[model samples]
Target: MTGGATVTGEGRTREPRDAVRARLVDVAVHLLRDRGPDAVTTRAVAAAAGVQAPTIYRLFGDKDGLLDAVAERAADDFVAAKAQAARAEAHRGADPVKDLRAAFWAQVEFGVANPEVFRLLGDPARVLRSGAAQAGRAVLQARVHRVALTGRLRVPEGRCVDMVQSAGTGVVQTLLATPVPDRDPHLVGAMWDALVAAVLVDGAGSADGSGAAEPTASATFVAFRALAPQLPGLTGAERALLVDWLARAETAAVQD
Candidate 1:
């Protein structure tokens, strides 16, 4: 008797209202992906979903509301994928750098491939307020945290996180902005190579003819900050103070 309800054999069973919303979202996602954001009109989505046009407004307020749903769904899928990849890497005891690289590649690919979704989630105000954006950051932080635990992180965790995130966003935006004919096939790998060289301590962490240096006071400070909460023999207040001091030092070092 309404939009999204299925006709059963003499039963007239109705699908749940949430199912109709999900169906509308799925249709809108396809429209956005296949035909760009302009294609995701209220009429287009409703007609495509086999629902009445008024149902769109009834279910999602307006066109903006529908777009928000699409963005939310896309973010959930993207974050879930990164989370799963991080989990699999952790479970396998794999090199975090390997996982990090993989995750970075996936992120770049996702951003470029899903320009509509990326644009929806790329707003600064939205990122600051969005729970999905925070979850994505948490996933990236976990990856960076694992790398820091390997004693190879060249910078403090917070700095490393900001650098990687900024670089990843830059790479995606740059690649997406470039013309297809002029896009470099090696740009992604080159970026990864440059980023890893900067963030990670490669070769022997020594001075015996190796380019890398021994872990310094700064390095120790970074390591301590990374593991500050778990160190034993310190009172809770002491640990908090140490963490605070280390954070200040990390910021000062960056500034210097």
Candidate 2:
């Protein structure tokens, strides 16, 4: 009624307002997935959805608003998937170590499976400035906190959630940043294994010969876990800097 042109669907000439909004979003998502975010525009979305441009604005407020909606949808879907995976792990009566590992892999798998959505949620330049991003981060942080409080992990109470959240974020960031051919699954798997191992095993002695002694991949994760508790007081940019340094150190060590 507001944005989309009326079309005959089963002999009906009237279009529901909700249907128009849904169509616009669906088209916008397809455009984003097929051709990056830059290609998604109000005009293009309207054209694709057979809706008027003003309708998109009315429904979404603005381009950024639409992007925010898209991101929220994607984030909600990902959170649900992670929760489901965790539940399945619980249902199977998984070992704590194995359950953690499975959860880490589930995050990575989702990122790889939905690269566009992953990028939308992860790009700092795009996300940090947005209210939607902050809201999404809060939701995720709460979920991480809930898991840590359950005491299934052998990590410090202060650092456990941060360690898991950062590791998962890093995995997605690495995958998105690297070239396709160079996106080695083995390397990703090793990084994940090292992070999980650090959480499950305490002290330097337990991690000896665990294949994470090398500073780049394994040691870096351990260091981050050790340092996570100090992060809450940091600014977003500061947190990014710390994580970047850790990643660089890990990369160098792994290459060595």
Candidate 3:
């Protein structure tokens, strides 16, 4: 919770603070989804949640604070979902490589399915200053490092991990910006496959084996594919951070 105001009266409203906070968050999320981030405001949230605006301000310090809280909640939800999905997949005797691929795809799918939640979690300004944001990044980076060290993927000196992460962001962002009705699952799948292939094939040479070639979209795909196997090892928080980064990248690309 971001804003909390002190009460002067001995017998203030008896509403449970947690319940009120939850309601406000729910309202904010709804508004954000239906109307965009700019649509969320103290007065709007309070009215929707059936609470006073001052209560909202008190629960969350300000609009930014409320946004941060909402993002935090979304991150928590994302992590829990990923963890559950990972556990189920692991129980099914999934290959680490396959598991990582599924996880990445799941993230992208979720973002597309829930654009409002994605926007809240992916907003760069809000994420950068959030504790949830920092934790999420650290988790992903650690997973990448771990998988590389385990030799699950051919990540060299952690460079491949960085490359894969960057490429993944590009892929997800591109997906987010494209109109949903116009999006082709086959094209998205192809992009992910291409990314995986480029990263997995161990060669300094280009796809065609020509001399050192300029990095193209195909090359980036290869870089990520090489690192995909290690992605599942990342913590839920880390996965969230990675997703957020991708979302932010997509936002930037759309603006450009």
lDDT of 2 by residue, 1-256 (tens): 3356475756657777787777787787888888988889999999888878999889989998787778776766666665666567656754434455556677778787778878777767667665655554554444443334333334443455567668887887788788989987786577766775655433221223233222234444545643654678888788878767755664554345
Give residue 245's error in model 3 in angstroms: 31
Q: lDDT scores for all predictions?
A: 0.82, 0.64, 0.62
Which regions of candidate 1 fall more than 4 Å away from where they truly are? 1-12, 202-214
Superposed on all Cα atoms, model 1 deviates from the true structure by an RMSD in Å of: 4.3
Ranking by TM-score: 1, 3, 2
Across 23-45, the per-residue lDDT of candidate 3 in tens digits comes to 89888877887888878988899
Ten residues in sequence with the least summed lDDT for candidate 2? 204-213
TM-score comparison, 2 vs 3, better candidate = 3
User: Against the hidden reference, what TM-scores do the models get?
Assistant: 0.85, 0.62, 0.64
**Candidate 2 wrongly placed segments (more than 4 Å):** 1-14, 123-152, 202-256
What is candidate 2's local distance difference test score? Answer: 0.64
Off by over 4 Å in 3: 1-13, 90-93, 134-152, 156-164, 201-256
What value does the lDDT take at residue 149 in candidate 3?
33
